[model samples]
Target chain A: MIQVEHLTKKFGRIVAVDDISFRIKKGEIIGFLGPNGAGKSTTMNILTGCISASEGKALINGIDILEEPAKVKKMIGYLPENPPLYGEMTAKEFLHTVCDLKNIPKPVRKDEINRVMKRVGIVDVSGRLIRNLSKGYKQRVGLAQAMIGKPPIMILDEPTVGLDPGQIIGIRNLINDLGRDHTVILSSHILSEVQAVCERVMIIAKGKIIASDTPENLSQHLFGSNRLFVSVAAETAAVEKTVKSIPDIIEYQIEEGEEIGAVSVKMKAAENTDIRKAVFSAFAAANQPLLMMRPIDMSLEEIFLDLTSAEVEL
Target chain B: MIAVYKKELKSYFYTPGAYIFMGAFLLIAGLLFSLQNVFAGDSNYAGFLSSLIFIFLLVVPILTMKLFTEEKRQKTDILLLSSPVSIIGIVLGKYLAAVTVFAATLLITMLYPLFLSFHGRMDWAQIWGTYIGFFFLGSAFIAIGTFLSEVAESQTSAAILTFCGLLASWIIDYIISFVPTSSMAGAIFILILAGAAIAVFQSKAQDWRISAAAAVIAIAAVCILYIVTPDMLYGLISKFIAWFSLTSRFQRFSMGILKLDAVIYYLSFSAFFLYVTGSRIENRRWS
Candidate 1:
């Protein structure tokens, strides 16, 4: 539903967003993953028409954002990094104002406002001033504001940034529900949150998109080696030797354990290779009892660090 | 546009800005009304109204200081700009909201004239004319304030800059008297103005070609005017200053002479400033 081609944004001498191109299919929940100052917010700003791009074009459902901003902007509901809000106004009043600005039909505005407020779990605080609300509620109010018009496309920049764990889970569930119908694009520095909520992840660094793929695929592709941790009732050196004898074992590390006569060994296997049975048989031949053997699936945290740190190296 | 207008108007009251603006203006107007009309037994309400222009130097900044600056400070402009509304709509809505408050305050002051009407003979035409002029003049000032607010980074700076801008306009007549009236001085002044315009253009467009072309056109036009009517060059400095003399135009209205040209001039003046305000906002997105 959205196509950004050769998008570039420059602030005087500093290039905020380099030549970045990506396509977002309808109903796809895409995560913009990057550290602070990695052009994630800049890319979001350009896509939503909040700022002009120095070069290239953005299209929403075949409509050019720049050529016909009014028309294209109607289809998008954007929640900026700060959640543009009027502190003096109540949440209800703010949403009403947003409804009017979005040009929603008058008859449905009230119902739409109520529905959005309830959806974001801000219904009880609707009448209270936004300034008086807690940060989590304020963030929910911002989310409600973005969802008010029920626009087909929603661009939320760090929607769950300031929320508590419960609020974060609520917001994640809300985003998951939203992804069923709306084309959602959310940005965040939190890898687990993005992995939990987004179907596709775009890892951005240094104003460029380093990788974009499914969360599982990103973790797997970036972590090509399969790792297994094993604790054996044998000497450290003997355990290392036994694990290294496996045909596909790429590397192994042995460390002394706290328990008497016990040693812990970590084994690394080649890409997509399952060395579980091989290691079991090798230790069995050595007459070494295996205390524990567990495969380690690369966590999103490892993937994020590896990808971002790898970019730093490049 | 109407939504933005209503929301902005409500915001003034929701915050302390609207009440403060109204209270401050009424205090000044009440003091002037009592001193000039009630104490002196003068029935000329237009004079009092004319004198109240200086009050705008203080209250107008209060009314408009937060128009765009506060939005930016709060980051709420993102909501407004990302919506379907046009930038012109947003600017005009906010501008009209400020003017509406000014008009509401001006409406309350009509009771001062009602009291004069009960106590003495009143010139209804002159009072109406002065009120019209005051409305337009105040609207123009608000437009200037709106433009100033867009350019300033904070509410304090916007308020201070607006005060300085309005004060400059108020003192422009006094400043004009000290300017050199000789034709050579006028020629030099026009050249300096042209140079400033060229510099502004160069910085904005970042292109020497456009600035050079503009400079050439300006110089050529001035030369042609000098050769064609050398007499027009005489006292040109005063005339140039007079063009910006918004107060001078108000004089005709205060005299109960509602000149169409003056009305058009005031309106176009406000419109021009508002247009510049809109363009500045649009330019910010690109920069």
Candidate 2:
């Protein structure tokens, strides 16, 4: 649904998005993972036609944004980090205005507004002025505004940021439901949210797309899949001796156990090694009960933090 | 475009901006109307409109202060900018909405002349000609106010800047009276104008090559003109100021001399300012 080619955006001397390129297919839910100032919002703004890129071009379904912005904008809905809302307007009025902006037929505008309000669950507060609405309601209203015309693509920047945990779940579910028909590109620092809702993740740092892959593949690729965590009810010294004796053991850490006289340990085996059997037998031979043994995969948060901080070759 | 117009118009009414502008305008107009025409038994309705011309100077900024600034500060411009609507549509929509409020207020004030008609004879052509002039003049001011609002970052600063801009227009004729009429002074002033233009272009484009090219071209054009016909530079500053002076041109309409050029002047002035406003916004995305 979107193709960005060598896109770069410069604000005076500062490069906000530099030489970044990516493509998103139809019906794909992609998460943009980055820390603050990671060119995520800049990329979203360029795709939505809110701002023009300083160099290169972006295509929305083969439509050039700078050449035919109005036509392209009609196909994409954007929810900026700060919801673009008028405090004087009610939620219904705001949505109606958005429908007009999107050029929906007058006959269908009423139904479209109502359906979107229902979808975003803002129908009940449609009559209340936006100034009186709470942050969660306001966010929903912003979402409703973007969904009013049923654009094929939705670019939501931190869509679930200010919502309570329950509300976050609700919106996450909404985005998942929306993924059936809409191409979703959402940017957030919340790694778990992205992991839960997105099929693919693009990690951006310092204005570059440093990595792009499925979350699981990223973990497997970045850190080889042989790392494991094991806890045993035994003396720390004995656990260390057994860990040293275990073959294919690359690196390991001995950690304090929750129970007295037991030790918790984490270890990384050699490439492609299934250290589980070796770890089990090693602990059994020492007469130490193996309380837990599981391979430890990298979570999205660690991958995001580590990738943004240092260079990682794919 | 209609959506933007309706929203902006409704906002003016919902906020106290339209009411305050119209209230102050009509109150002063009413006081002036009753005192001059009713009490003094004057019959010149055009005189009343001409005398009330000062109302637009104070009230136009109130009508236009938040037109673009509010959308920007609230970040609601993202909706408008990201939508399918064109920048011209948004600018014209907001401009027309502000004009509509001023027109509606002017229509109410028309009842004053109708009241005078009940008592005695009135020069209907002169009355309406002045009304047309006042409408165009107020529209021109609204356009300036709109441009200033776009330049300012907040509503308060927009209003203050617009007020100062309009007030400067009110005193432009006096300011021009003191400008030097010598060719040297005019050439110097033109050079300064070119320098300012180059400065603005340099800051926006951030490209020394383009700005330097523009500066070279500007200087060359001025030098050629100076060498070709130096007389053309004499009193050039006053002519430039006079060409841009909205109120001085409005004097022709107030005199009941409906010159085609003056009407076109008022319209073109408003169009020019509005075009600047549109460019200011359109350039925002690129920059």
Candidate 3:
């Protein structure tokens, strides 16, 4: 339930967020993918009402943030790039303060705090000062702080930036868990994290949104041609001739295979075209046994690089 | 606002800030009280109360330096700003928290007056009046300290800046006496002030038309005053500076007289600075 229209933010002469527009439906988990300084944090900042946009507007549930910030901000739970924490306070005390800030009723404040602490898996460290906790625990506390009021929307900026791999998985699972009831918009440079956790990914580069789609669709759309990698027990020239004979195969490359008298072939066919049967029959006619065959799809990481790097070239 | 107030108040005690301020302030105030009253057998509590302002000037920085600068340095302001709380609410909450610590410490100092009352015939009117004045004056100073804290980037710098600001206000009365009293000088000073106000307004509003209109109106007002009544402009510089003399108004209070205007002056002074603090914070988000 968030909408941004032609939003732009300029810091003096430097534009931090160029003209950008996007909408997120209720309960949708959206990820902002970008390298550092790509306006990911800036956009999150604008959406959370932590900062003002220089032009255009952002709305939450049809309410403009600038027009009625208090009402709009009440609906959002934001975890900034740096977790906004007081070092001297314990994690429990910090959550209590957040509950107060969120206007959580006194009667239910403790229960809410406990629920959030357990949800973020920080119940063990609840009594410890936030400063003494490890990085992962501290981040969880930040997450818990955001989740205290159970707001409808959660905006996390690089939620798992400094965590260990296990912690990263923990946070990703936590986000996925949140997605069941909350609309989540998180930003990160880690492509696989977004691919694994988000229903949609928006690639932002140079203060502009370059691509927005589902993880699978992004890769499939970028690499329109279907690719097949095959290994055949035959001479390299024979495999190459057999592959070239397939009318549906638009491009082919034959290389010597690792095994003796074996050749590997890589080929691309038109979109939605299945050249597997044609290649099988041709290879069968040539009496070259097919050792292995598998379809190759571009990974999210590769698609991300291809898209973001293309922006740099422009 | 209550949430922010409680959190800030708790933070004050959680760190060494409140203790340091109260300890240093009480130690010095007690030393001064003992020297002026206990050993000398003097019952002139007003004199001791007046001297306590100097001690307040020193320790107030400790009470206020981390109010906002620490929040900025720690980046916790993001939490406050992103919450549903209004900017005014946040500023007022933090301001009241600092004032609460000051009020609590001032409450302890009541023992000094109580001891004097037990020994001699204390002027209750003068004592209570001075106490009220001292509270408001200290709050005004805290407001200044609060604004300085918001302006500086670090706690150390905020402390230094707040101390310097209080020091300037402390000596402003003395500085006022040496200023030129000639109408021409007053006219020139008023022009400079108007120019500075216009510059500040221009930076904040970014509307040249409003600045130009303000500049034109200020010049017109000054010219009319210069021509119609030069006498009104005589010694205007000192009078203008005296208007901001926070301590000068304490004379009425110390003499056992409660002037309504003086109380209002202290209150409005605090309100002015607090309002400016809120605006400064709001401006930061936009910038």
Candidate 4:
């Protein structure tokens, strides 16, 4: 339930958020993928009403941010990159303060705070000062703060940036769970996290949205070559020559191994080609035993790099 | 707004800022009351109250330094700004919180006056009137400190800038004496002030025509005023400086003469600063 139209933010001479636009439907889990300084945070700030845009406008449920920020802000729960925490305050106190600022009814404030704390798994540390908690716990508290108001939209910027692997997974699961009812727009440089958690991905670079699609489609669209890694009992030169003879084999690299008579060859085939059959037959005709052959699916990391780097021919 | 106000008030006590501000203020008031009234055996509580203005130079910063600077440094402002709370709510909450601490501390020092009432004759009406003026004056200073804190980037800078700002206001009466009283100097000063306003407008709107027209209008107004009312420009610079001299207005309170204009002036002064602080915060979101 968000609409952004040609939003731009400028800091003095530098345009932090270039002419960018996007929309999120209700209950959609959207991932904002971009390298550092990609204007992801700027866009999030604009959407959350934390900051204003130099041009264009953002609407939360058709409430223009510039015209009626307080109303729109009530619908958004923003967890900034730094968490916006008061380290001196205990978790419970912090959440209570957030509830108050959100104008939650006094009757339900305590229950709402507890519910969010339980959701983010921070109930145990509610009595501890936020400064005494670890980074992961602090992040959970930040999440708890955002979820306290039960707002329909949650904008989290790098929610799991410094967390350990287990904590990251926990947060990802929490986000996925939250996505069932609330619209989520999360930004992270961690490609796999976004790929695993987000339903749709928007890849931004230099303040521009270069690509937007489903995570699977983005990976598949950016990956133009099918790679097949094969370990074969054959001479390196002969294996390379045979693989190069395949009709659609675009490139091949052979790695000589310590094993006296084996070679590992990585072969690249044209997009959508089944090169395994051709390679197997080619090796079979030469009496070279194929030890292993497997197609290498491009990882999200590679696709993210390919999408964000300037050299990518969008 | 109420929520923010409550939370802000609670935070003052939760942190060391309120304690430090109150403790330092009471200590100074105690020392001053003893020295000016008890040691001297003088029954004039107004003199002791008048000397307490110096305490604001130190403790006002403590009360207000963290109002906005700490929020910015901690990034907690994002939560406040992104919430349903208006900028005015946030500013008022912070201002009232600081004022509350100052008021609470001032209340503790009321014991000094009670002790005086026990031992000797006391002018209760004058004492109460002076207190009202002092409260308003302190609120105005805290507002100025709040605005200074918002303009400064770091807490240390905010504290230091607020101290300097309060110091300037403290010495404003003296500084006014050195200002040029000639009509020519006043006209030139007015022109410079008008130019600064036009420059601010140009920076914001980035429209040369509008700023140019504004500049022409300002200069023409100044020229017409100079030609029509030559006597109005005499001592104009001193009058302008005196108008901003917060302490000069505060003197009426210490004299136990609570003038309506002075009370309104102190209130409007505070409102003006609070408005500036709110605008600065809103401008930050756009910039």
Candidate 5:
């Protein structure tokens, strides 16, 4: 529902968002993955019509944002890095003001505010001043602010930055629920959370988009080898020799195990190769017992580190 | 626009701003009312209202210190700017809310004339006329305060800067009498204004060619004006300062003569600053 062309943003001499373009489909939960200051928030700001791009254009539902900002902004619910809230007002009062700004009809404004408060689980504390609310509740209030008016697209910047574990899970679930109807474009530096919720992920680094793909596909396409970590109850040299003798094994490292008389080995096998059976037979023939063997896939964290650090070109 | 106005007006009451502003204004007005009209036997109620012009210089900054600057500090401007509302809507909404408070307080001070009504014959025309002039003048001051607050980073700085700005405008009328009235001084002043305009244009357009062309056009226009009427150039420096003296126009309404041109001038003054404030905020997205 959104398309950007050669979008660039300059804050004086520094180029905050370089010439980068991308499109987001309706109802797609796209995760903006990037490290700190990687133009994630800047891109979101431009997309929501909160800020203008120095070059090129942004279109929302085929309407140029610069030409029709009021219309485009109406279709977006933006939660900036810090939620724009009034501390002096209660959560309910704040939502009422937001409904006013969003032009929710008075007949349904109360019901709409109730729905959002319930969705974000802030209904109980709705009567309390926002300044007195905990950070997690305030964050939910921010989320509730964005979820009001039922805009087609919801852009949240770092939705889970300051929260306890349970609150994190709660917000993640809330976002997942929002994903059913709203096209959620949430930015976060946390890879695991993005992988858990996003159908597609875009990795940005240093004001440029380095990669974009599904979480599983990104990890698979960037990882060149499968690895195995095995702990054997045998002499270190024997474990090393047997692991080296396994077929399709490119390289292996053997280290003294934490347990006595055991050797731990980390071996790299060729891509798509399964060497567990061969290694089992080799150790069995050498009169050494296999204690533990597990295939290790490169996690998304490693993929994120690799992508952000320019380890591979996507 | 109404939504922003309602919310902004409501916020003033929700916080201590509205009461404090009203309280300070009434305290001073009451003290002046009793001291001059009641005790000093000064039957001129319009004169009492006239002397209260200095009240704006002291309290207007307090009224508008947090209008936009507080929004920036608390980051609530994101909500206002990112909404469907136009920049003009936000600007006008806040401006009108402040003007409403100012008008409301000015109405409360109407009790002073009512007191005079019981004790002496009153020139209702002159009283209301002066009230009208005072309202417009205060509205103009509030517009400047709103613009100052928008440009400043914090409420304290906005308040201080606004105070300085209003004080300067207040003092400009007095400052004009001491200025050189020579035609050469007028020419120099006009040229300096043109130069500053070109500098401002250059920064905004980022094109020296267009700015240079504008500078040339300004200089040419000034020269043409000088040649057409050399007499007008004499004392032009003081006249130029007088043009911005908001109180000088109010002095007429205080004399019970409602000049339409002065009304338009005051309204235009407020409108001009309000327009600049709107554009500055809109330009922030690009900056």
Candidate 6:
């Protein structure tokens, strides 16, 4: 339900978001993957109407944000990088304030806030001052603030940055649950969090969208050759010799296996080649038992590094 | 807007700012009341009301220092900006909240006059008029503090800057007395004033051509004024100072003379500063 066209943001001489364009459909959970200073926050800030873009425009449900910010802002809930919280106020009071800002009716504000607090699991700390809460609770409070009005879209920047591992999982599952009805857009440094929670991934670098696709497609399409890790019940030298005999195996690294009297070899095969059968046969001929073999797929972390740093062509 | 107003008003109480301001204000007002009316047996409350402007100058910064600077330092401005509330709503909401605190404190001090009414006859009309003037004057100072709070980076600096700004206003008449009132000096002063105004407009518009045109037109207008009525140019600096002199207008209010123009002057002065504060906030998003 959000469309951005050639949006660019400049802070004096530095370009934060440079002519990047993307669209997010309704009920789609999109994850922004990038390193620090990748303009992810800037893009989110522009879309949320917190800051104006230097060029182009963003439309929420076909309404220009700059032209009608109040109407557009009503449809989007934003959680900034730092949770915009008043530490002196209690969590419940903070949510009530957010409801008021969003123009939620007074009678239903309490119920709405309680529902969100329950959803984000911050109900117990709702009465405690936000400043006294731990970081995890504060983050949940931030998330609860975004979910109070149940707006159609939620734009969260680095939602799981400082939370513990368990809390991170809870927030990830919460985002996944939220994606059932809400269009979820979150940015995080944790690759696995995005991979687990997002339906699609957009890799941005230096204010440019380098790649956008599903998690599986990104790993499969960006990876040129097949890589296999095989364990053979033989010495390292014999495993290396067998690996050399197979011309399909372009590169190989042999190391000792965890299994006694065995060697594990990681090998890269030619494009689309199935070295599993060849390795099985070669090891069988040598009277060496083939213990295990499996193809290795590139992880999202590698793809991100490749796209962001190496600037790999799609 | 109501939400922001309620939150800001409640926050003032939640922190020590409101209490400190009110405590300090009431302490001084009480001391002055006891010393001037009780000890001196003075029936003149106008003098007492006139001296209360000093209280506003001392404590207005406390009431306004955190209006925006704290929001910014805490990064809570994001919540306000990203919400459906307009910038004008937020500014007015905060502005009115500060004014409300100042008004409530003023109301508490009404006991001073009520005690005076117990003993003998009092000029109720003049006393009420002075109260109105004091409210407006304090409001004008609060507006100035609100604008400076947004301009400063931190609360301490905002408070210090606001205090200095109000101090400058207090001494504006004295400064005007020292300035040369010759026609040549007035012409040059008007030219400098025009230049400063054009410079502010240039910074906001960021167009050299428009700014240059404005500067030329303003210079040409001043030159024409200088040639046409050199006599009018004399003492022009004092006139300009009088136009902006906030305390000078207060003298009329304290003298039991309720001038409509002075009331409008105080109101317009507050509105002008508040409008500039709103523009400064809107410009923040672009920057």
RMSD (Cα, Å) for all candidates, in order, is: 2.1, 2.6, 2.8, 2.1, 2.3, 2.3
- Show model 2 residue runs off by greater than 4 Å: A312-314, B194-233
Ranking by DockQ: 1, 4, 5, 6, 2, 3
- Assess each model's interface with DockQ, reporting 2 decimals per model: 0.86, 0.83, 0.80, 0.85, 0.84, 0.83
lDDT of 5 by residue, B110-180 (tens): 88898889988999999989999999999999999999999999999999999999999899989999999
Determine which window of 10 residues in candidate 1 chain B has minimal summed lDDT: B182-191
lDDT of 4 at A235: 83
lDDT of 6 by residue, B1-287 (tens): 89899989989998898999999999999999999997898889889989989877999999999999999998999999999999988998999999999999999989888898888789988898899999899989999999999999999999999999999898897888888899988889988998999889888889999999988998888899899998989998888887767898898888888999999999999999999999998998998
Number of the top DockQ candidate: 1
TM-score of the second chain in candidate 3: 0.93
* Worst 10-residue lDDT window, candidate 2 chain A: A305-314
Model 4 CA deviation exceeding 4 Å by range: A257-260, A310-314, B198-228
Going through the candidates in order, what is chain B's TM-score?
0.92, 0.90, 0.93, 0.94, 0.93, 0.93
* lDDT tens digits by residue: candidate 2, A144-210: 9888788999999999988899999999999999999999999999999999999999999989998
Badly placed stretches (over 4 Å) of model 1 are A243-248, A258-261, B200-228
Q: Residue B252 lDDT in model 3?
A: 83
Model 4 native-contact share: 0.95
TM-scores, in order shown?
Answer: 0.95, 0.94, 0.92, 0.95, 0.95, 0.95
What is the Cα-based TM-score of model 5?
Answer: 0.95
Screening candidate 2 with a backbone cut-off below 3 angstroms (N, C-alpha, C), the clashing residue pairs are none
Candidate 5, which segments miss by more than 4 Å at Cα?
A246-251, A311-314, B201-228
| TM-score of model 2's chain A | 0.97
Instruction: Please tell me what DockQ candidate 3 reaches.
Output: 0.80
Assess the local accuracy of residue B125 in candidate 5 as a C-alpha lDDT between 0 and 100: 93
Per-residue lDDT tens digits for candidate 1, residues B1-287, read: 89899999999999999999999999989999999999999999998999898886688999999999999998999999899889899999999999999999999999999999989999999999999999988999999999999999999999999999888888889988988887677777788999998898888789988888888898888788777876778888888888888888899889999999988988998899999999988888998
For candidate 6, the per-residue lDDT at A258 reads 93
| Per-chain TM-score, chain A, candidate 4 | 0.95
lDDT of 1 by residue, A161-259 (tens): 988899899999999999998999999999999999999999998899989999998877767548888888997777777776789877778889667
